[model samples]
Target: MWRYEKRLQYPVNISQTNPKLAQFIISQYGGPDGESAASMRYLSQRYAMPYDKGKAILTDIGTEELAHWEIIAAIVHQLTRNLTPQEIEESGFGPYYIDHTTGIWPQAAGGIPFNACEFQSKGDPITDLFEDLAAEQKARTTYDNILRMVKDHDVCDPIRFLREREIVHFQRFGEALRDVQDHLDSRNFYAFNPAFDPGQKPCGCKKNQ
Candidate 1:
């Protein structure tokens, strides 16, 4: 049994729009390395995790990723600001403008649609956590790359925020890894993947060893 909270971890307000930058940032919004994929991957993978701690981390992180997905969408909206009808048509934003009218949609920079194939949800806890950790770093790197590509303060601010979040998430996953592995039997700690051995004690906290 799990409890879920529906809320964004942060707020996003993009006051201006630049369609050019919007196109670029949309990659992180809906691309394979986007927050949308990251969130979905972790949350979906939680169901297969064998331990409560892993499940808790996955749910929390997954929910947060949804918020991040929203934030990225907000950034895209901001970046696509003030497009005239002519500009929209010339810039090839007309198709998007027709449907969204400055609203956010999940699609890559090159207009590649989002798909579930971007991520995985293996039932194994250790494997899943490792994947999550890598995902966070990948997102962080993407944000950094975005920052490098753009000079807008509005875009950079949110991108930086997202980048910091990746660092924080990586730390949390590290702690979760420690919690899960430390619980294993001392003798078998290094014998195999730590998540598979339930016989391992919690935290390896033996007082009389």
Candidate 2:
């Protein structure tokens, strides 16, 4: 159960319309590394999470990813709103306009419709968490690419916010992974961590240094 908030997590007021830019940003809405996949991946994986910390973080981040999706949607909407016929054709938005007509639809910039294959929900917590870490980085990289192309402060500011959240989410997931590992029994299958951090105490979750 979620408490419905009528406000965006971060405010987005894009005064100028840029259909070309919207075409690229729309990928974050439904692309492989997009928030839509992140939300679904984490939420679905929580069911198989053996650790409470893992479950909690997954739910928290999953809900937040939904908010990120809305943010992306709002950005895309604002950029494409009030499009003229010539702007649509020149921006190469005609195909999408034919289908969505400025409405939000789940598809990559290349027009690949979002699908379940975009994410994973493996029952293994370690595997899923590792997958999540990679996902966050991928999203951050996508945001970095967007920031490079975006010239408008109004557009890049909110995108920067989203990018920062990706980095934060990556950190949070890292903490949750360490927590889950720390709490595991020696006899557990995942107890033998092949990827254990070097130059760190084996009992690694307690220190800040």
Candidate 3:
């Protein structure tokens, strides 16, 4: 039930080709804290969330993560476009070029392919929300690392936008975690899985009540 926008969440227009920079940036495309993992994690966890507010938060943020993925992919594609054999060899992109010449593939800077093991959907709302919060921070740090190596204004602009989004998502997830915590007994928040074990009544501690 999603519609095509025909536009990126953030525009990417890189005038210079830097295969080395592309190698580093590609990590965010499929790295552990990458957009693909973030989107999948939140979208999958939403199904087991116990509250409507939590579910909505996960759903909206998950969708936004997909858009972020598109932005990252565009950056990588633009960075690697119109490369020459000499540029590939000089820029040390041969290893990647041999595998997928100038093509966008999900892999870490070291060439580890994207894997589902990077994220978890624990089904427990608290656990999943906490994971979401951590994921955003991890992504932000990754962007920080990228900004340190990149000097292109065009490249940095969209990346900074993505980095800022990580902060905003982290805040939203913090709020969602608080909302979930409010429903559980503070003394024993882990007493039961809110997404399951329906018969176990909440402890109704003073803090939660």
Candidate 4:
């Protein structure tokens, strides 16, 4: 159902190798608020989204998150490529190197392996969209942290692109949240679960009420 694209969503061409930088950058690959978590969260939540617009937004953003994941992987790959053992030890990548030499694995900066616990997929559309918005902001903050520690233009350029995307996605999710809110009864947004309580009217009160 998905088409293959031979190109990266944003091109990454790093001329220098820095295992230290790679260590931090790898967090975005499998860390909390990372692209992998974002993709899975949105894609999984889409099935419960009641509105077509919400579903579409989730689908589009989820796909885009996958693209961002690939970007992060590429950055990590380039940064660790051609690393010498001496360079790895000096760069403080020795612990990581011992486990997987120059091989890209999904782990947080602290070496926590990627896990679903990093994100949530509540069946409630409101909760999920809010989580999406928060996820984007968290990702943006992570990128800012990376930018502060890194000076290489080759690395910073792509990181900046990814950060800007987080902003855009945050905006889109905000709009999606507003759309869902508008469909709910003004009296009580939580009166009913729109996704599960199909027989209830859009603005109707709770079934028990």
Candidate 5:
């Protein structure tokens, strides 16, 4: 269960409405490297994680990513607010308005809808951690790209915060990966997966005396 918080993690108060910019920013909502993908990636991967520390990391960061998703929704909502029909048409938000009427929907800047294929939840710990590490970096890059195009102070502020969190997530995933490697069965850590493979020493298990 999650506790409800009425306040945003970061405030987004845009004085100007810019649907064009919102179009670009929406990608991080449900786009490939978006918060939605990041949240699902870690949470889903947590089920198979071999270590509690890794699980905890995934839970903490995954929940945070959900909050990040809310922040993005807020940004898009504010950006697209108080638009005239003419403004919407001229800004090239016509296609979106017809579908959702200024509602929030997950999709990339390029117009591709959010898809599960965007992130992976591989059952293997090494594989999943590597995937998480890469996901965080990619998400960071997305925020970086957003920053480059953003000129408004209100938009830039929260974008920067999100970008910083991505770096922290990457560092956390790195720590989880290192922990996994350290606990691996040295004799066969490379030979087989202690998480799954049998007929071999499992990580964290003692040999029969």
Candidate 6:
């Protein structure tokens, strides 16, 4: 049985609106590199995980991603609300305004359409964990770019929060990788893979220095 926590991992508040920025930010909300895919990918893959530790990692990370989604949505809402038609036209948000009227969508910053092919769930623990590690790095980079582009404090606050969470998720996935290695028999761990070794040290999950 899974326990549910409704609280966000971090708080999000938007004090003002900027339609142009809102459109760009909403791209990540549902976009390829977005939080929605991150959470769904991990949570969905948990069904095929063979170990409890792996399942737990998926559950935790997935839950955190849900918080991330909320933060992005909050930012979008704050940035897009109450825009005059002239302001929308001046800001080049007219196209989006015409379609959704301040609605959130998952297109790219450049207005490219979002696609689900951006993420995957391979079911193999090693493969999936490796993908997750890479995904976190990608998301961190995206947040960094967003921060550099936006000047609003309200927007940057949640973006910074989301970026730091990526680093933490990367570290946790690294720990999960070690957990996977520890589950394997040493003598046979690298027997099949001749290109590299699985390393000598077992997982160090509890003792963080």
**Worst-scoring 10-residue span by lDDT in model 3:** 199-208
Superior by lDDT: candidate 3 or candidate 6: 3
Q: Per-residue error at 69 for model 4, in Å? A: 0.4
Over 1-209, each residue of candidate 5 has an lDDT whose tens digit, in order, gives 78978988888888889999999999999899999999999999888877889989999999999999999999999999989999999999998899889999999998899999999977788888999899999989989988999999989999999999999999999999989888876555565554676335346777699
For model 3, what is the C-alpha lDDT against the true structure?
Answer: 0.92
Better of 3 and 6 by TM-score: 3
lDDT of all predictions: 0.78, 0.89, 0.92, 0.93, 0.89, 0.78
Tell how far residue 147 is off in model 2, in angstroms: 0.7
lDDT of 4 by residue, 40-120 (tens): 999999999999899999999999999999999999999999888889989999999999988889999999999999999
For model 4, state the Cα shift of residue 201 in Å.
Answer: 10
The TM-score obtained by model 4 is: 0.94
RMSD of each: 6.4, 7.9, 4.3, 2.7, 3.9, 8.4
lDDT per residue, candidate 2, 1-209, as tens digits?
Answer: 88879989999999999998999999999999998999999999998777777889999999999999999999999999888999999989899999989999989988999998999987767888999999999999999999999999999999999999999999999998887677655466365332353223456466578
What does candidate 6's lDDT look like per residue over 9-127, in tens digits? 67767777788887777756777688988988889778767678888999989987987887788788778778898999999998877877887777776677767787898756677
Q: Which parts of model 6 are misplaced by more than 4 Å? A: 1-8, 185-209
Tens digits of lDDT, candidate 1, 17-128: 6686787788888897898899889888876776687778888888878788878877776667677888788777776677778877788777788999989877666677
lDDT of 4 at 141: 100
Please tell me which model should have the higher TM-score, number 1 or number 2.
2
